[model samples]
Target: MMKKFSLLVAAFFIACSAYSQYDIVIVGGTPGGIMTAIAAAKQGKTSVLLERTSHIGGLPANGLGATDIATRGATTGLFSEFVNRVKQHYIQKYGAESKQVQDCSDGFHFEPSVGEMVLEQMLAEQKSKVTVLKMRQFDSESQNISMRNDRIEKIRILNRESNKIEEYTGKIFVDATYEGDLGAAANVPFRLGREGKDEFNEVGAGRVYKYWGGTEGEGSTFQTDNAVQSYNYRLCLTNNPAIRLEVKKPLKYNRDEYVSMIEDVWTGRHTGVQMLQVTEAMLEENRKHIAKGNVSKIPGDVWGIARITNMVKLPNDKTDANNQHMAFISTDLPEENWPWPTSSWAWRDTYAQRLKDYIQGLIWFAQNDKELPEHFRKAAKEWGFAKDEYTDNGNFPRQVYVREGRRFEGMYFFTANDATAVAPGKRPVIHTSSVTASHYALDSHAVRKREPGKVHLDGFLSYPSAVYTVPFGVMVPKVVDNLLIPVPVSGSHIGFSTLRMEPCWMALGQAAGVAASLAIDDQVKVKYINGEKLQKILLGQKATLIYYRDVNPADANFEMVQQLGLRGYLPDWEARLNDAIDQQTAMAWEKLSGKKLSYEAGKTTRSEVLKSIYTNTAPDNRNASSH
Candidate 1:
């Protein structure tokens, strides 16, 4: 009897040793999570970020290098601060040839490895204010989050390393994971699907087809049919000559498995056609600018693309087309992601393996296959995968493509009406809420081909809404008081794409942190937090609270100068704004701050302004004091 009692006690101790907690716990150390931790620390809150992998960057560290930065409007406060830090890394490494300063105007391209370093540095700066626990997950034995009356009272977490269980009590919790695992563990009210047009009175909201570029057959149809947004991993290819890494076949390789999709390639209906067109467009644009005597990189042998490039160009130039395209038409990993984004380790792991295989196979195709042009084939070969980034996995990064998942059905759902066009009586909102304003067309891809030679495409509508407001209610959970999701996964599918830029994500993360801080300080529910009060806090922090339409002070182009009162990319509206805003124009406007400029007034050339900002002589306006 004594021996049996001793065995029971031992088992109980082992079981209890599986969970632990902190004041504010964040899951998934992606950029959003990093920003959240930094925001919490800046607000003087106790926070801990738990990462399932050793690396911090979700996809940027692995292969996603593009950062979707919509609107060239100057964003101050936390978002600006983050960009400044990223700028600093380029200065330290490349000095005179740094790409950071030149990359951002109407937003610029970025390399993935460089991005990983930038994020890690940002987190390290806030070391004292935040605690980061890498390589941790909530297993069955460790999955325990207790909430009391809409507040998280106690969170017991299992320390996998030391085999110990601990409890943490907090006033607020944030789910920053690309996959809303924490929200699932807490049983938050969430959703995943396209709301039929009948549900929201939206025309392009349901299944339809309207092609762009061409159809799947003609490379012209941008269609849709009850499809969630597409998802894809970003590949950071290089032709740097010095970096020559051989492409390896995925362990799960079976060439026969890709026959149908591969057949698309032979039949000239390959997805690579659109990719080539997009790439060629960029290369041609670069050439056109160079011909005009604007300083630009020559259309190089190698081209880089990312996850967000398909629909929106991230501030960094990534794409989300990995899973959006079906079979060989996209990244071909939707089936793999079916079980993913869940809290179940088994499901997550299986999906993880599939992503690895998919990405690897894609790379192999880009290198050895006849699908890609010869120039691209040679250029893509010179680039080597970064070693320092994505330390969590030997092959890929930590972030999986989370197109649409666990959208918390909050107090207010931002519908197409609110997003398509400004609704009547909707005032220029001033809220503690921080979300991105999207000017791009409401875009979605077709899931299935509608005809034998046609594809299902719809929602490529250009009717854009006014600068939509992302309310705090969108981030706040309806049932879970302490939790908030700011990655724009908080809103509907149409809304998420608009809000899914890196800068916007940064803005929302900071806003969420501020809201969390308030919930902790005032001891109030996130739902009940005063919007007016939140607006004050945001303005005080230099966040854009109201999207005022006053002629911004930054539109001083040479053509615009001649047409003072006129509103367009240029004063004359003669120049059709193309690919990217010009560097020379950007430089001049930065110094002018929207004031009318006479070409003769001041000899501050683009070179001079570049020198000033790059040399640190320009006044740094991203600091807290400026806010």
Candidate 2:
């Protein structure tokens, strides 16, 4: 049966063979792959983008309404081009300047079909240079990888769907998938889950801590520590009331598992937590929790869905269909995501379907079930499914949330020191410094139960952090010699908290593609590539390579930001400069970015309000990931 299946797979690729050879072969139709293909094409390299799924743009097009771009400068290269296309698409669809905030830039948040259209447009722009293969699974056994000394000679992709296998030789290959499958097949050493302090001699390991949202990694409490942040699907909910999208039940669904998780959440067990620490206290506390494996949070909070809090608004409007947002309160299908990174396609699909069912079940329970009250029903009802969010699959997103995965042990290991703002002159000087700046503190999930006896879930944590530089070396591996990681699973188990943002991944993907192209053209290994040359290339492409240390906070741009929109956030430069960035403020960026301000001079905050509303000392917990 296995042999027959193999032959059938071979037959599939043979029948649907599209392109035979190319300069690059990128597996996984993830955003990272899409961005890499775009970058490679723009660099005049012939590339083949093969994805297991039919659509592209990954999560942003799937269900994540908000895309996380750390900084204005990080939005350059192919990533910038994609954003530009989104702007143009939005303008064409919604009239001129209809969605633009006072900041003069149009916001992201367009329909999912529009997101696909934008990617398709990008592919069209580089038509001759790139070929996209959908529903094609790569088979390493058939590829016959011939390596001389250290470089890869050729790789063949067997299209299981069409029964056609295509072989191509290339000087470089990028493992752009969320799961570093290609890298693993190529014998790369990667780390999954948390890398305790003992592994890297760092302080933020082996324990669970709470990091707040706001500033850059600041205001964190010792709520829980030493746990990886949970994962879930970003539901594209709308309160439009005009459209009626039914919440369907998932197959093989069991309410018991969720019921338990949510039960723990109601008791403030494991819901509210940051992917990264935001505050010094939260970091410390998270360390303790990691040691104990008893992370907890509030179940009833809306942020309980998926604990992501930092959300920066883009040039587009909050209402734009393609616009991306981040938050602490989200529908995180935690139990569903555990198997995806290592699962086979069949398993992954089954897991995703289960996750969809879980989310649908949660929504249905919230709306129809008697457990929720009048206020909860009204609030949830206000949020419905988007009419044009996910165009490929029931307008439901096709991408799964990949919070953390394989971290390649690269030439340069990005440690806690690299992510810390106080590292002084230890900043890594990379050939290409992407425009994004990550501020969220090192954070992880707090495994708890749901509230109201509905489902066990809890989420929220205000951690402390400062904007840190992302080294180019983090993306490239050390021993494997050629592969580059372009998505959430880039480098640093703990540091992935901040770098995992969609914009950051796309930024890295664009840079990795550019680097691969350079390596091919200049005949240099990824590690040996000239930093100055790479930096020049990146800067030329408008990626913020330098920290712009000389650009005063009082510059015209700063003043313009103040005068136009985001009045509340105008003081962020001063507030965050001396302190760490928190999660709440970061999440606020998703809905407000350049247009609306997230803070006021003096307003008793939400966390504080909640604390005052319900005060209790959390029992001490030790983290297992701690040193």
Candidate 3:
């Protein structure tokens, strides 16, 4: 009888060992998931991060070393720290005065391998508190979620190699995947396509078709559709023969895809004139380079009929190439990515491979096609994949760039109106519980083709926008009590165009981690956490919750600047107004402190006015110290 009892006890313990609990379980190891794990671990939470592939850092570490940032000053918190670390890495490797160090002085760009190294180092710093499980994907098949009273109790994950299953229970969960797979598996309500203008009163929320170098177009500004933006892999290429892998024709290459492109070039539809028209100086510069016997290296004229010439310079003669719009060809394949977000993992892998094949074929066609211009062909041949990058993936990017994906329908729906500052009185609805600021333009790639050779560039709105705050509600789902969605966030298709930038996603992930830590510590639902206290903690973490153009520690009113900035009263305080104590400064002070001040001569200096503002408005109970 005692032997039988021992056998039963052993079985029970083995089952329990298979299921473990953590303070936070984050799925997906994109920048957002990495930041989430780092933040939660810093807060002393037992955090676990699950990545679907062997690699992490997503596009930034894949091939997109040229950071797409709108306003550089808006970067703060963990994202800013990551950039600074990359900057330091470059400075340490190359001398500070070197061109490579100067290029990364703005703390934005770096090599793919350098980015991967820095991200891995960050994980290493928190290895004691954070656990990273690679090649573990959330199982959507068995619907393996244990829920009780609408809260997710545990999630079952599948090991891709071994096909073994393990359960993880977390006090709070974060859906940081690019496809929103966890939120979808949890049965959260979500909208897949663009919403019409009337649905959210968004002026830039619909389908659009425009001809290249022409005004011919059709479609309402608010027309709704199920179409999504195109996705592509950001290729890291090199011109140096020492580490360059020449473009090879894929086994599945088809010449039919190049027929239209060749015809367009012959018909003058794909000439380089459209790019030259950007400025007369650029046209002159191109002519000068061509006159100097650099026929194959003329600026903006290297791609012939293909529009794959958007190459941003990286260190050591490398580049990060992306798509550009030409009359006939573009790097984006909108039609091929329709089912990627909803497909199974196996199907998604097949789709990714097909995209890789198509992009490779396009490159080979541009380089070796006989009908193309000889100069352009020679220039294309000069560039190839860098052998030093993505060594495990055969010198190719490990992941395809998913520009936009499943947006969570959360408590606060950030719409185009919110992003465009088009609320009542043409002012943005300010969120007092702001956590991070996003300043990128509402930029979306092509979504559909209106006709042959003409594509509808829907969801593209380039407007001067202020650095806007992302509210905490954007990450908290309306239905899920314990889940936080940092990427694939709660926003409309148009709003997500700006919020989907890499740095913004990292900021949101950091905020989600902090919120998750607070909720776990207080033993409360994420929605019930104190917003003010959460904001305080975020500020302590060096998060930029507000925008100011000229308010740093150097100012005498630095405390007042930060205090008012935290409440979202200062609009462009970062703008260096004239050195004089102007009336505009007084007006801003009045708006923030609710007390008007006279800007009379000799009445008060700028420093005195700021001191008074700080004395009157500073919170007495809260500690005023920087992190």
Candidate 4:
């Protein structure tokens, strides 16, 4: 009886060890998840970030190092800090004036290895509060999530390292995964594929066939269908002989899959295409100055790897090669990834390998296929894998870029309507509870395979958008309690196009992390956190809620200006932060303060006008103060 009692005591301790508890549990170590953990740590909360894969930084860590920011300063917060650290690494390693610095393009462009290193370095800073567990995937074999009503009690993870099932319980849960697997497992409501254009009034919604490089919305069709944008691996390639491992032909290479490229080459489809230069700095001075002429041929268009894909320069003589946006049959493989959101790990791996083989086979075909022109073949031969990147994974990117997945049907429906301005050169509709901002174009890749007479692949479109705010409600689901999903957020397909960018993901992740901490501290559900308080905490972290050409996170009046923007006040209309307030400002102040308070010329600036508004409008502005 004594021996049996001792064994029972030992088992209880072991079970406790297996069931780890933290303040927050975040799934997916993508930039969003990483930042979520970091932000939670900042708020004096402990979090456990579980990554299914070996590395954390997601697409940027893989090979999508070239950021997709049209307006760079629109996103700051932890993301800005991340890029600044990356830039500092280059400056420290190779002097600031070195050619490597120029290629990095202000730290936005970097090698895959450097990206992973910086992400790991960031995790190290918050190690005490943020625990990262890689190779721990959500167990989908059974009902893995323990939920009481709408709240997820705990999540079951299959530790690939230990090959054992484990449980993680937390005060708050965050679904940072691109696929939103955790939320799906918890039975949170989500939308899998495209919504009809009329469903959200999104121009490029549903089964749309849109053409590019011509008119913006010429010759298009919109219909309702369940289609997802293609997924591809962003190859980190290099022609530099010191680090070049020529792409080897996959074992199961098939010629028929790549035979279609011969037709593109035979015609002038591959020629005269706008040469997306290696880097913005590399754009010829003539092109930059817009030298117009009756020019028949463009420079760097005819041959080489550029014919196959678009290569953006990164530090240390490496290139982040992505799908050529114009090509229908480039890296993007559409129509097959619909099952990725709720598929088994075995299915995802099989799909992952399929893309790996397809890309490798594509490269192999370009190099060795006799059906191609000789000059083009030789040019393709010049490029190879960057040997320094993904060294453990055969000089290939470890992760396939999953651009879109299960979007949570949360409190807010952020759509294409929010991204584009009602009128040009003005801000979009402002959200008073805005937590972060992004300015990436509404760029969606092909959602269908090749179709005859379809000039552009079905569902491939890119349109520039105004800087926009993503509200705190975007990350909060309506039906679930104590859960926050930053990626695969509650937004439409067209809206996800711009929000899908990693910088935006990181910013959202940071907000989710901080929001999780706030929920735990206040003993409330994530949906019920004080809106003004959350925005204040984010501002304290140097996050930008609105884009101002003149004002920045560094400015003393940054938070006040952002606060004013939140109240639907456009002081100077052109984002002139220093400009004195006009009738618009006076009107906004009167609405907020309930008193007609007008400031004299030079006596009070726009910042002062906004400060007054923020103080009067906010229930408790103590936490919202910037100074």
Candidate 5:
């Protein structure tokens, strides 16, 4: 009996020591997470992607088919590849000259299922090096993270379905969730909601509206530290009756909640029409079809035209519906999403159900309500949840659109100044060796007040800005050594509003994966990895580290010029002809391009300097690979 007891003890110890290990462990299978795992796998690193839900491609796969990108040139690396594949998917299904192919030329919009299929195919291509575990939730409270000094050695996960705890060990960990769950679990310093204007001297910081449906006279622009933007589910709707699932009245449907919105539209306080011209064209098409006595065949484009937030048209008569800026009819649920960042899974699910109920109730009210305009009612009735999309979740989106979440307080905090290029003469803080380039306006959904119809547009800034580089420091936490946060990055709320797009997140994820692989190779902290070496790797992988519309990659010294541009050595002096290149700038340019330039006032023309720089840095063997 004693010998048997000793053997049992030894077996238990052996089992405990055999926790599953990988080169990298990614928590939260958002687009960023999926891209991170894929990027790491491409580098021959064994990786594990643990997703909380059955789906993998978060918002893009769920319902956000309309890619909200500022410019196509701004995208690079895996994101560019993904968009290209999406375009090819349409081109192959439809002829190259079809409208589907033409529309997807600049913007790649597809059905939610297609997004999932593409992501699955991409992962399958790297299945040997990547392990994806769906329905695995990260237990922040009970799970243990084995920490050796500042680095995390292992992470504990609680399976949501099995109710079993499992441990995963990895050399580097990435928190790619929109919520920054892994970073929160690791006890890294992070910020929830907006910051005070004084904190980062941000022009767009603070709460703007104090009352809903009230004029600016009744609102204030005071900074509130706890005001977070709204959250919603990007509904995938289709007009085809064959695959359209009628919007059923949710169990907790409440008519009183939608009374204010209906009244706003009825009183003309809020226009029932959409803000974009696409909706108008669709409406005209519907009118023409009706005049021809073919109302039934009036096309699905006429449906969901009233909601301008994101009424993006997709292939196969499907649409991706998102929140509009309407007074109360928008999908954004104010004051309800505040607890989502730190809430327990049970609480989150409850909140998610409430949002679904609210949205469903709104749809039902718009379609069936006698008080609404007849045309609006008809349009609403034409659309329903796409039966083929998100079939596992009752044809609803599997993931709610989390616009913003816990932003890490990392090595560098990007601010609104960095977003809008207000300082340094229309130049945002440039991290020349950036992994991603973002050029979106600082856009935030309405943050309504306690009043049902009241909302503040404090976070909306629509001014166009120059493309800004997302620095590697934003991914590396200041205190945490091994973790990388690509989605809920280290940026101010206004800054995040610009970087929060799915494409940029995927780009950052790719960068994080490369940085992690390099860190593991060198056995150094993420911050300690050589920036130039990492940049070289990213550039080699076709990642865009600098933004120069005039400079083409096919140029002789394009690589060197880009490298110099990233380091802030190459300034657009022609655009700022009145301002001369400083001595420091000239020295750095010479050092990088190996060309000396005259710093004397009015001595060098911009074109001459550029030509000289390119000639000096051009490769000795022109036939050699640029990479």
Candidate 6:
């Protein structure tokens, strides 16, 4: 049976390769992959974007409507363009003053269908250069990919629609898949699971237990393990009867999967499912409960289905439902996803279907199960899958939220420290070769299943992160000369939590497109491309590479100030163009240029001196890539 199956799989790529050679071939029609194609299109570079799913957009298209953004300033360029288009989509479809427009929250909040429509609109604009082939999964056996030396030449992907293997040759290949399947097939060295605490000295490294998303401290004895974070479906749900479908029990429903929730309800640990309506009294009560450190007892006033699941609001009375952050028993299925990174197509599909069934069963159990409390069941009964969303998939989302995947061992390895500050309350490490800036907490979901005496699942951590820059090196593989990975990027497990956010991934995708174009233009390895030139091109496209407090994308001196910031002159947030340089700024400047800067109380200001230096100095002399 095994031999016969192997022969059947081998028959796919035995035929001739389809399509002409492209300047860039990107796998995964994720938001990152989509932006990559669009960015390449802007450069008049023809590219092909291959998606495994029927739809193009990843999570955002599925059910991730509430955008995970720390600040609007961190997301720009193509991502900003995408958001503006989403807002416009609502404005045109409904009126500019419609309730849907107000619900969009400046294009940040939206429905899954709206998100997909906006993304498709963005892709449509690049129809000339970007050819999107949906339902195409790349074969990741390391045999289908043709590699000459360290560069990828072509990849053979199985077209699920026609059951044919189509070969795509490209000057530069990008692995934007959440799984990093193309990179793995091309033999890019990568890391799976958690790194040891001492390996990177990352604060959240290793396997251990912690509370309320506060990660373990550095230099701990916890050992590294192949325990990836949990995976789940971000279900788009609505209570509106106009477009609501019953949360029916899946065909293969199993009672054991959700039987544990009954105990949670009895102990008052599992809250009701309705979205919470908070008041000042509820807030104070919740605070005191947490301060007391007895999580088994949630405040009576705040208990509900909201405790176990997150329902971030959207337009049309819908929600982008997700696994609750602090909920011990949530939608996320941990430990079982260990095989997902390297699993075969058949195995993955089976597992995904099983997971889909499992969640569907859980919802059914919550709504109609005999063991669940009457009030809990009633709270859940009002909810159902949004009928208008994912109509082909029976209102269920298509993409399962694969938060972390195979992180490549690239030129730069991002650890938890990158998201942390140099000192307490200070900015994170400023990269001179920064391609983008993003802000998100180190939010890793549970890495293990329920364990005895643990408040939350092990490795379920989340804490604040400083707004930090992502260096170009994170996307450049050390050995893959022509390949770049923007999604399953070069990040450690803890560091990946922040980079995994869709908004940041879009920015990284933009950088990958620009870098791929540069590599082809200069006829150099992706690593050898000029960093300053890449930053300049991205700046021209309106990307915010370095984030500052006072100076934003709107500032007239934004580009110059950002360049100066890279040179270590403007260390603080504010540019303070006319204000005298502080001691910290003076010290940072001296450290960069080896010259003494005199404040003289008031005469010298930031803009006066910095702009003069910038105009006189040649671009190469800036030494922005010194880091």
Which candidate gets the maximum TM-score versus the true structure?
4
Cα miss at 91, model 3 (Å)?
Answer: 1.6
- Residue pair clashes in candidate 6: 213-462, 271-304, 272-304, 272-305, 273-305
Per-model C-alpha lDDT, please?
A: 0.53, 0.53, 0.74, 0.80, 0.73, 0.81
Where model 3 places Cα greater than 4 Å from the true spot, the runs are: 1-19, 211-216, 219-221, 267-306, 421-429, 453-464, 552-560, 566-568, 575-627
Alpha-carbon RMSD of each model: 12.1, 15.5, 5.0, 5.7, 6.9, 6.8
Determine which window of 10 residues in candidate 2 has minimal summed lDDT.
618-627
- Score candidate 3 by TM-score against the native: 0.87
**Cα shift from native, residue 124, model 6 (Å):** 1.1
lDDT of 6 by residue, 425-506 (tens): 6789988888999989888888887765454577877768888989888888888899989999998998888999999999
C-alpha lDDT of candidate 2 relative to the true structure = 0.53
Per-residue lDDT tens digits of candidate 4, residues 1-627?
999999999999888965598889988989999999999898889999999998888998999999888888999999998899889999999999998888888889999988999999999999999889999998543378888878888888989999998889988988888888888887778887788877888867876655554333434556667788899999998888888898999998888988887756544243122432233343443342322422113343345566668889888888889987756577878888889888988899999999899999999898889877666677789999988788899998889889998888888878998988878776777777778889888888888877776656778877778888888888888878889999979888888888899999999998998888878888878888867778889989999988777888998878777767776565333556556867755775687667667587555676676666666664434322111
Model 4 steric clash pairs: none
* TM-scores of the models, in the order given: 0.69, 0.69, 0.87, 0.91, 0.84, 0.90
lDDT of 1 by residue, 517-562 (tens): 7777778777766554554466566565334343232333321221
Worst 10 residues of 4 by lDDT: 288-297
Shift in Å, residue 1, candidate 1:
30
Which one is best on lDDT? 6
Indicate the worst ten consecutive residues by lDDT in candidate 6: 270-279
